[model samples]
Target: MDLIKTDQYGRQIGYVQGANIDFEVGADEADSINDFEIELKRWNWDGSIRYGTRVFSPDTEYGGIVREISTDTSTNVIRAKGDTWRGMMTKKIIQPLSGQDYATASGELNSIIKSKIEAEYPGLFYGVTADTGVTVNNYQFDRYCTLHAGLVKMLKSVGYRLDIRYQEGDVGMAGYVKVSAVPINDLSSEYELTNDNNMNFITDDNRRGINHLICLGKGDLKDRLVIHLYADQNGTISQTQQYFKGAEEIAAIYDSSGSERDDLIKNGIKELESKKSSMSYNMTMTKLEGNIDLGDIVGGKDYLTGISMKKPIGRKIWTISSGKEKVVYKLEGET
Candidate 1:
């Protein structure tokens, strides 16, 4: 008996012959043949365990970065051409704009509008940039309207009738933005809106990051109004609020304390009453805690930066004073 080898096609690719005739093995006789142990030689031309490859031309291939390359002979797999724009088939960036490849697409559109407007209306749209206003809550346009007095005058001069579509009320980072729209006659309406478009009379937890001014009326009047201060996103980052107390109250307290000094008990009661309201001055708040100082002393050149006041226990009184003269009141606690 002689051992035999077959290719993958079941055709007798190779076989060995013996000197003495013993038996011929049939494909169906599986149980009877048992004496031979087969060993393969390199002569068999079935295929290599480590496959070879053939070069493919570009004309026949269809894919990104098509090029002439080799392919795996065993599994018939083609090599990937390492082209820079491989994923461009699906995610392509096409535009006529300035700046980087992956920059914000809206910026390019804005540029187009600006350039077109400038060319069409030369000297008219001169400094026309992204303008932001204040409102109340986060909602659709129509809550509030805010316009820098200068911008309003400029737009009005150009024969454009504008209306506030929405605005950020609190005028802080977390506050809403006012929206504005204008009719452009034959052209489309200039429909602009901001994300902050809600009533901002009160503080919202989401808007704590916004540095707002609690306007206690100029000179500490009875009606203390808090105006949310929000700088333009593309403007300077002013992160402090100047606090000024009414001059009349301070003067009255000082006069009362001074006149009754002769009567010790009367002066003491007057002093206590005078101290009832916290001290007020033109101070700047830079941080949350009273420990952080951020402004200059009222009449002195001493810099007070990173100074914040902490509220007293049980009461919402945040006191910061020097040498018996109190300065700054934590209005956030009261508001």
Candidate 2:
């Protein structure tokens, strides 16, 4: 892979191609900031690589600003590490003015995200766009948190993801970062990895999950609001309760501050969904076809374990070393 060096402003400085460099680039669906690291011999250093510089890989579609750089005299190697554009968002906190507890917004998800950036730190993010085409009625973000955390929480609630990329400048113009909100695609049927296809995978089935939640709301003693919610096989919460025998059943309590029955139930449902049984898979493929990416649902089946699942790609790591490349994919909810 080619590692192109650029200034902090996204202006190309130089590039290293077919060099004996080792690097790892990866992203997690649950996180706003992705990370990349580059390690190469001291002889390969162009003397221009320094702190605040940016390195981009068009082949891997991964790049980031260099926040830290270290040189090893014994090994004669140099290492540069930093985070992607999402890291920049983490530096700015969402602070609501006096008498406010949160920074709130409503309407389209894209517009809300853009407005937050423009309001908090204008010109930091350019070409803000959204392709998810999702809209939310209302959302509130806790104060004193990074903008990245706030946006991640808002987007996850609506099943969307954030993507930020650096666009190199044209001629004398300086490059800028592009921010986008995209929908998580369901490509389970289109991409399948099974033992039959000689794919290696490990399946984890966590059975220590709660199926019932007894919610207790505001008030005291018997006057307090109380409700029971059950999670079914499909992870749906409802008032209709179902009981299981022996080890097959699990239950928990959800202490809520809701005074209304509807509000309590809604809170109960959110809590219940989190406690449902988690099933995930981890697999490493040497060669794969088609365009598969993080947040895209994929299919996997392990015949030895009798496990079949369709889950979103939660994280991916790409490593290049010794003239070989390896990519690892972990399903959502996998540790």
Candidate 3:
């Protein structure tokens, strides 16, 4: 319930009322909750403060950049605006760039985040975290478009999330941009939605029939991504046929013709299915704590629907607003 403003170096400059801070802090989208934004408003403020005077609530620990400054010198009217740390990255649209073959492993990915990306874009990353141990697969990039798009696509393809950890990072690190590889719905926390607790629960059944995917690759070998072992292609997908019948065919940027292409192909199918198959549940928790952010797993119950979700599910916070601060979450599991 507090909003503090800081200078470019994160030194406290001033503070604002909690009501003046309005933010959409959750990755509410189905699976690609890549980023979130915050907005601060004030009736009268210092216009001479200049740029880089950031503001953010201590809850997120993520600093925001003062990008927009509105002022009328004649009337002495003024206003200033800013966005969260991730907002800075989304604006950095990358151009079409091609690169030679590169090996992508858990360690290599972390190295890229720490060295290459962080070097190019300073003050964005803090450190890396536990990654699913996978083989060193040869991969290449051709026109990533943007860091956000490329990073999310690559991470989602591998059945993982490029989670943004706002608090509690590496031992020596003391800033933002701590990325982690967290599997979706790796439900680890549990919660109960009693009649008086849960505001409401909504369920959605994906009937687009995009349950299966035909992942295609590129180059002379026409390197196709292998997905049979990791995902179901013939049984569960082929069984249903109503609209957009059968499997969903998609194209991928295949750069190599090695056995390692398995990761690429598998990731492609998983990325699609992550959005295609399965039911989605959304519930409003009356109160959300600072610890409950993106990439955390929790469970809830909907007694009215008579649908008692058996297992705990991974969820992402989509929205956070003041005045009782109604928080909404998108659940990732079966109901």
Candidate 4:
């Protein structure tokens, strides 16, 4: 019989006594194939046993090296929903106003105004619209006013719909001023001045520039102004009312008669310089009405010369004469 040890699966785990064991036993006792024992010893010839260290001296037999069909049924095949397969998702909180240190509220207001226009009008985002109004006459002095003036001019230059209002009153162009912060959804209290009315004053012989521009020019000369004046007051004077055809027209006119239009242009420049010399007022507009951003207050030229009052300055009080009637004219949007 072929003697060998194997599990029920017919897979051998260990060998039984050598195939020739029984045959060797049946041989003569003396010469009984001592080669079988020698062969077994040779098979187990480990260096550890050679050095007097028993290598495989087990305390008990392990049931002849079982193969048991494993009965375990333990998982070896990985399932689709295995522990290794995990779903991963992520979330983050991104701050809209983070990282920029030099960002200003006024700057934000400017951007907001521009964005609103860009969104509202898709194709006409640029190209000069009609001159809403001459800046010299409608110039604003307060911070918000100054900001709005610049904003309107900028938007107008790029073909944005910013319908500026103008008015005239008993005292020249009274109520002919528009001043306001760019409307932001976050802030409820935003300063805005939108008055389209009229004021009364002297209609001068020269129709070159606005009254304020003329007021800035202290005196008229043969071809220029002798002395400059302050044009701080904010109102739409009559002279600088109409707009030139365009920059192209102005350029064409300049090219056609190089020194011919000098009289008109020089006169206009003088008036503008005078108006620019007028006092400038600044104001702090913020979401928190109580606290103004200190950084926004900086000194400028020809105006009040320094940061405007932290609080709003009341309307400028003026008296034509010592005993003249005290006319209470409150300039709207005075900062």
Candidate 5:
């Protein structure tokens, strides 16, 4: 396990101890913001106040870069906290023409966003261009929002699911990002947890059908109930009509593009399906244990529930001067 520390200019100044280097995979909030943290011994750098100088680190993982580095000086350690490349998507605000080809506009904006970050912190990431197949239809809007949120909107405009992954590397790779995308129903489940592996805060809330997905339409499409049109026709479900106070329509930039209305309906259906079964657990794995990729499906049997499937959800890593560093994988899944 190796963690190469870099200076503000992405220079290899020093290497931190693998034993003192503590990190984990995270999905801390509802947005599933996948992040990783590095808590290491304070290092010597120039032009920066005690851990104040901006620094980026390309750890021994799969070319993943930690965009920011701070310190946990309380313990005489330099703690660097960072999120996945997706974090770049939120740092900027987006405002595209409603009539612009949704696909072209998004591609352009994504390129623009990456341009700013890549100029500073260059990593071994796979997509420095518009290789990701995410697209949105031309939608007129008189607003501004986080480009990350907008990317989610564009992703839903098409039928794709975001699949996020994080792993504390193998034999020598420490940890790296294996997957972060605008789509991932392609997730696989794993049965890697057992009593030998410590686990805490495990719970499951299974409701046969308790999802109410509502999409508000703007203008003439206001108060339109498209639930039945998109929701499951399974006889074991119930629904209601509701008003969408802030719904707006977006036409596709291309003649062969998907209908805006159809996009919204499909988006709603995805939400409902995700609510089918909910499970939560806090599984603690030794730093040397198996790999954990955020947003991937993990299947296992608990001391109580016997067997179940879980989605790796949240993470919190603890760094100690005692040399006992550990990683926690917060898993949530729909059965």
Candidate 6:
């Protein structure tokens, strides 16, 4: 793998060669901020690489902005580490204007994101696009948080993921950031890994997961709005269960500022989704047949445990050293 250095604006600076590099890409839900590090001998440095420099891997087509650089005078080695473009969003906080408790938006996901960015930071070079066709009737960011956190929260509720990439500049143009809301791919039917295959994996069966939530909404005591949220057989959150083997109930107090029952239910559902039992699988494979990427669901089975599951690929890490690369895949959720 070759590392290419670029200016903060994405203009090509030069190639970063003869360095040991470790690059990682993460799904929106699991680890949204991808990161990388490079280590090389000080004598081999050309001094072109500095703070704010962007490093990209052509093989992975993933890049990150340099955030820190350090040196070891004793060993004459320099190391640089930074977060990917998605991390840039963390630098900006989403806050409502005067007299408003929440920063709100409606309409298509992409349009809402674009509007927010343009409204908050005019003339910003970032671009937004979406093809997931998801729209929210009412979305609110109540507390001040990083733009990345706000966007991830909004998209996760609608079954989408944030995608960030750097688009190379065209003629007479400087490269810029491109953001998108994309549907999480369900590729379980196409790819399945098992103990019999050329893959090594570990299964985590967390029995302490919450399966039911009793949500309490606005109003006073007996008059307060109430609702029950459950993770059904399919792991889908709903008000009632058609088939129930056992119940693990917990009380969840909804935001007092939210008066609508719909809002309560929505918040409860999101909470239940996260609290469910985790039967997760973490697998490492040297090669895969299909084009499997982050945010895509893949099938896994452990014959010893007789467990078969399909979960989203949450994170991927690539280590390039000694002219060899190794990749690790992490799947989120359980059977």
Selected candidate, larger TM-score, 2 vs 4 = 2
**Model 2, span 148-175: residue lDDT tens:** 7788777778877666566666775555
Clashes of 2: 0
Better of 1 and 2 by lDDT: 2
| Candidate achieving the largest TM-score | 2
lDDT of 5 by residue, 1-335 (tens): 34454444334455545324444333333434444455545553232322322222333221235556665667766655565445544555665557753323434334433543344334422223545654433533225655555544444455433333333334333333333344434233445556655544454545344334545433334444333422232312234423211232111111212335666566545555655334455555444234444444454556565755445433434343345544445554211
On TM-score, who's better, 2 or 3? 2
- What's the candidate order when arranged by decreasing TM-score? 2, 6, 3, 5, 4, 1
RMSD of 3: 9.2
lDDT of 4 by residue, 1-335 (tens): 12233333223334333211211110111212111111122333222112111111011101111111111125321111100000000011112245643222232333444443334334222223323332222222223222223343443333332222112123221121121222112111242311111221111122232333322222234543332122222422234434332331111111112233345446545545543323333322112223221111111122222222112211222112222322222222332
Please tell me which predicted candidate would have the highest lDDT against the true structure.
6
Regions of candidate 4 where Cα sits further than 4 Å from its true position: 1-259, 266-279, 284-335
Query: Candidate 5: what lDDT?
Result: 0.42
Task: Report residue 9 deviation for candidate 3 (angstroms).
Answer: 4.8
The digit string of per-residue lDDT tens for model 3 on 1-335 reads 45555656555656654333344433322343333343323444544344776565553534465676665666554555555555555555444435633323234454444544575567656546444663224433335345554554555556554555444224333335465555555343445554566357665544443444444444344344433312233224322243342245322232334435556555555565564545566665546544554545555555556544422233333333453444455444322
Could you tell me the lDDT of residue 14 within candidate 3?
62
The global C-alpha lDDT for each of the candidates, from Candidate 1 onward, is 0.23, 0.70, 0.47, 0.24, 0.42, 0.71
Q: Provide the RMSD of all predictions against the true structure, rounded to 1 decimal.
A: 33.2, 4.6, 9.2, 41.0, 10.9, 5.7
Kindly list the per-residue Cα lDDT of model 1 for residues 196-237, writing each as its tens digit. Answer: 222112222121122222222222344333232322222222
The candidate 4 region of ten consecutive residues with least summed lDDT is 81-90
TM-score of each: 0.12, 0.76, 0.57, 0.17, 0.50, 0.74
Model 1 residue 309 CA deviation in Å: 9.5
What's the distance in Å from true for residue 268, model 4?
Answer: 2.7
lDDT of candidate 6 over 202-269, digit per residue (tens):
87887566667778777777887878776655677777754454444543444444457888877777
In model 6, how large is the Cα lDDT of residue 322? 67
| Model 4 accuracy (lDDT, Cα) | 0.24
Q: CA lDDT of 209 in candidate 3?
A: 37
